[model samples]
Target chain A: MGKNIFRSLLLGLVMVLAIQLVALAADNQFSGVQITVQMQDHSATRAIQKLLPDFEKMTGMKVNLVILPFSAMKEKQLIELASRNATYDVIMLDYRDVAGYGEARWMIDLGQYIKGPLADPNLKLDDFLPTGVQSLTWKNKLYGFPFYIESTMLMYRKDLYDANALKVPENWDELYANALKLNLDTNKDGQVDFYGCTLRGLRAVGYNDYIYNGFLKSFGGSYFDDKWKPIFNNENGMKALETYIKILKDCGPPSVATFGYEEVMQEMMQNKTAQVIDATMLGTWLEDPEKSQVAGKNGYAMVPKGTVQRGNSFFGMGLGIPVFSKNPDAAYKFIEWATSEQVEKSFINEGAFMTRSSVLNTKEFKERWPLFANLIIDSLADANITYTPILPEWREVADFVSIAVSTALIGEKTPKEALDNAAAEVEKVMKKAGYY
Target chain B: MTKTRRDNTPQWILIPTITFILLLTTFPMAYSLYNSVMDTNLLKPYLGSTFIGLGNYFSLLQDGRFWGSVWHTVYITVSTVVIEFLLGLGLALLLNREMAGNRITRTLILIPFMTTPVVIGLIWRFLFNYDLGIINYVFRIFHLPQVLWLSNQSVALKSVVLVDVWQWTPLVALILLAGLQSLPIEPYEASLVDGCTPWQQFRRITLPLLSPSILMVLLIRTMDAIKMYDLIYVLTEGGPGTVTETISYYLYVIGFKLFYTGRAAAGSYILLIIITLISMLFIKLLRGQYQEQP
Candidate 1:
């Protein structure tokens, strides 16, 4: 009796295991092809839901999104690609990640694919705001395709400027002159409650990218020469740092050093600052009265030019394919569809910043988001890819550099001392990681 | 050697406990220790790992960042424990006495202690903001210098410590209060008849009786404080220039952020050793008090 019962139990267990395996197999579409994408969940989980159906319809392939926070997205992409696991077929590689992922043979060389069917006729790759295309390349190989790109522009209260009869400044001298005129302290208050401008100085990578990069670029400071050595503490760099400190201290609110992205956004929304600097992405929310306090009253213009470099900013996310991917053809087709004009139109309609020139010029899109449409194209025109440094170990080095910048801004260390110390530490880390 | 053998009591209890512990604890502990001695990257497999012996440990000893994190962890742990103990004891004494609505007050005290660490951190962060925060608004209205609570490196660590104390002090109070309520009445009566002052009676009779419970609370608090990561992480992110970076936070950034798996393992083992030593010392002290009690 015991032997008979044991045989029956074994048969039941085998049936259950077989059913589970079949369920798992059914969950996978595209049969043998798999792709992974690294994108930020910035607007909750539904950010990617609208585009998935179109991608599937066009290419008949399955995609798996390994969603990450904005803070960790770049670092996660580098680590995952370096392993050559083919863990992701489509990756959201920023300009900073292109150098490392390309050189390491982790990303499939997209030059061959781009010349073929992946290059959509309507979505001309050459027309991708020259600066955006330049950021997606390393040594003639276009490793990534432009997705959403941004350059910082001046966001100001048009009402405040009109009430005070101030023209928007196109240069630093004018900016300072106007800032002084706008520092208003109303109603017998001893303190200056309303400041002219507010910007990020916190110890985070966004602080360095948005605030310090503009200052350095405008001051004629280069991160490295062709030989790759630190040149950021030279005369030009010092002049830039000095100017930044002076402006922030003299015109900014008392707690500017601790202001991060959220704080600056809040301050601008509250109309506490006469002028603020931010990426073009904010234009969508800033123009909506339901979301913004200064909705129609906000003025958009190109970031003012400085001593040498023009008004400078950077590109955002780019798409790349893994070298180990089994179906590079299918993956490239999906990338083409994802960045095509139709998809770009849909995303823009949903309030996402897409980076195809033809899509940005569409009459309907222009009419609906005029403020974003006008300033977005102009800002990208003067964009300099050199301003945002691209190193193989950028994630590690960028953080240390951010800390140094924060210390300088907070008066914990002088600019020269901070940069020198930070550069030395970065060199050491690069050597240890075999980057040099 | 009796004809009727006793049920193997020790063996029955020993077998299940040993099996449970070996599966859950011993295996992971051994695996992590083994990984610490070797240099391996989880992402790469074709490029095989090397056995570095003690190379990772030696490098960590020379790393200034490691020592900085260790010092930060020690400072936070010591400060939190001392403050929590004193404040918790004071509340326990106050609650022990008769008061209006004492039961309601005790229930209210436990509410903060019952909430999760992440919730506590988020609430406190909202309170400490320079703008749109109630604390800052009150300070500004009073003409006081508004503290940049989460921004200034000098003040960020202290702010997190204060949040921790606020959440966990009630736990200590409840434990000490239970101990106070359980003390015998004869000692107090005897001390009063001996003409001892209130301070003397507290020192001579009440404290001696409460030593065991106090020692128990200290041990538990020290262990919990050494492992504090979530609260500090959510509060400041080891920042304002890594001023609040504790040992666990450093390990997390290296392991998960930088993908330095070998280095992170070594750092974690160092933390384990320090915590173990602390626990052992507290247990020894508690054992001494237990033996001294009657």
Candidate 2:
């Protein structure tokens, strides 16, 4: 009886081993395949890199990661796509670039892949943040998988506000009033030691517009009408420009006009500024004890309401397979794995923002970044990409607007004159692009 | 027969180098020239490359930003070159004398020149930062009001020039020092025997002899300054209302950011023409100076 029982146990172990081999074979079907991924140098990409070895081991596929800074990455991707180089199988694409890439047919539509063999019941597209998914979709065709979403929000020093008995700003007027009130010289050195607020003021094309467009949109200003006519020189547009310039000039740092995202975040993190209306990404950096002095002393809010609208700006960084990719199948496999719910949760734990609603709603995430998770959800409702037009000429138009806004900031031109000049230039650009 | 073969061998060796150079430079240049006259909008390629003769040039001529950028380029080039030359000449003269740690000082001066331009730009950007910069900190120590080095439109261009001067002045000094070391001691001795004062000797003997090196340095630096991108790109990015938007930076915006290939090519050709003209004028002046020399 004992010999018969031992023989039965050995047979059971062999059957289990055979089933595991078959499962491994199915998962590693594309073993030995190599795909190159091009991405921007960011914390999210770094997290993906850390997970790549596990992916390689599981799928038996090799991933060659090429990470570059944001601007250089875009330029490289553009050059590669234009040249039809099959150098990169996967690329990190900005949602703002969807229109240009989609219209150019440079990226493959992943809609079919979603419903086909790569589809997993657990990987639901509906689970992603609606704005993020919509941004990556052009003409009802999904061109990429949303990786992370970002929107503008108001971040202020909670300690400072409570100590001063100041209320969280609900509108532009209150924001400006609070900024002026908080612009204090804490050291009493006859100079303002701490600024009240900071925003992006760099004059590069599309840079300043990213932050200032919130003001423009909230003031009932639109970049262009349906006919592509320049409309930013209207009364509302001038008011928006004036308000943006006035606030920065009066309550912001003396060098506010030179501040970009990095500068503003640094200012706030170092506790030199009491408030900042900037990117959601700044919240994560500011909460880190390693980089920030006031890690837990911050309060998050949706961008203050403008006169006519909140005009919050929304953008997403996504992953897309280029049309020129040689290993599209393997590339899709990797993209799916990287954007999977499991990986997204891991990414969040590693301090990356997530685009999936499920991951964001998870008890674990809410407990980790309690302040930002709630603010992100609230801000997404009012966030609009109209501030950044989704067109090929959008970059050029944003540049013109940035120049105008910067000119107003530096007193080179009045808000009205600057907007008028920018409008004329934009019209010229549109005409040249055959937008008649 | 052997002499003829030897001569032919040199030609054969020269052919490969010439071919390589032409392939690298001439092809892109010709393509740019062709593209300048054609509607080659990468975004609107469906429109096809149409021959639009002088259309881009005419548009650029009417472009106020283009003209503004050209003016900025001229201002930056002239100011940087002038300041660098003066400062370099002064340092070169000082170093030319017998002094303690002269070799160490010369090597130290070359450090800025040795550093990458992009790195130099970043370092200077931090140093000139309005709030946290060491410059403003020093000003604060003296109880002086803070100056908006990069934020003020009037001061932004000057701040960029200061960075350029800091980086390239060492190069100019090195070049002028080499020239100073090569100068004949006999002329100085003769000038001293003639009871010439130090200032007089320098203004006459030193300045005349250093003119060739000065002109060479000016020529090289002018070309570089006109095409200055990395410094301005990293430092101010032609910010503070485009006060520092040099021609090259503007062309980069048109090409890469705007993706107006045809317009960018045309703008580049225009810049090329300006650079060629300026270089030719400098060459002519240099030739005249050479001819004036005994």
Best by TM-score: 2
Q: Taking the tens digit of each residue's C-alpha lDDT, what string does model 2 give over A1-436? A: 9999999999999998875675577577777688999988888889999999889878878899999988789878887887789999999988878888888888999998988876767778898888888899889889889987788899999999999999998888999999998999989877787988888888865467888888888888888889999999998898888888888888888888887788889999999999988877668898999999999999998888778988577778889999999999999999889899999999876663688888888888888888887787778767876665788777778778999989999999988889999999899889978889
Name the best candidate (by DockQ). Answer: 2
lDDT of 1 by residue, B185-246 (tens): 99899888889999998898888889989989988898888787898778877777677888
lDDT of 2 by residue, B121-183 (tens): 888888888877899999989988888998899998999899999999999999999999999
What is each predicted model's overall lDDT from 0 to 1?
0.76, 0.87
The predictions' CA RMSDs to the true structure, in order, are 5.9, 6.5
- Candidate 1 residues A110-171, lDDT tens each? 78876665566665777566666778888778887787788888888889899989999887
Model 1: DockQ vs. true structure: 0.24
lDDT of 2 at B274: 84
Model 2 CAPRI rating: medium
Model 2 stretches with alpha carbons more than 4 Å out? A1-27, B1-7
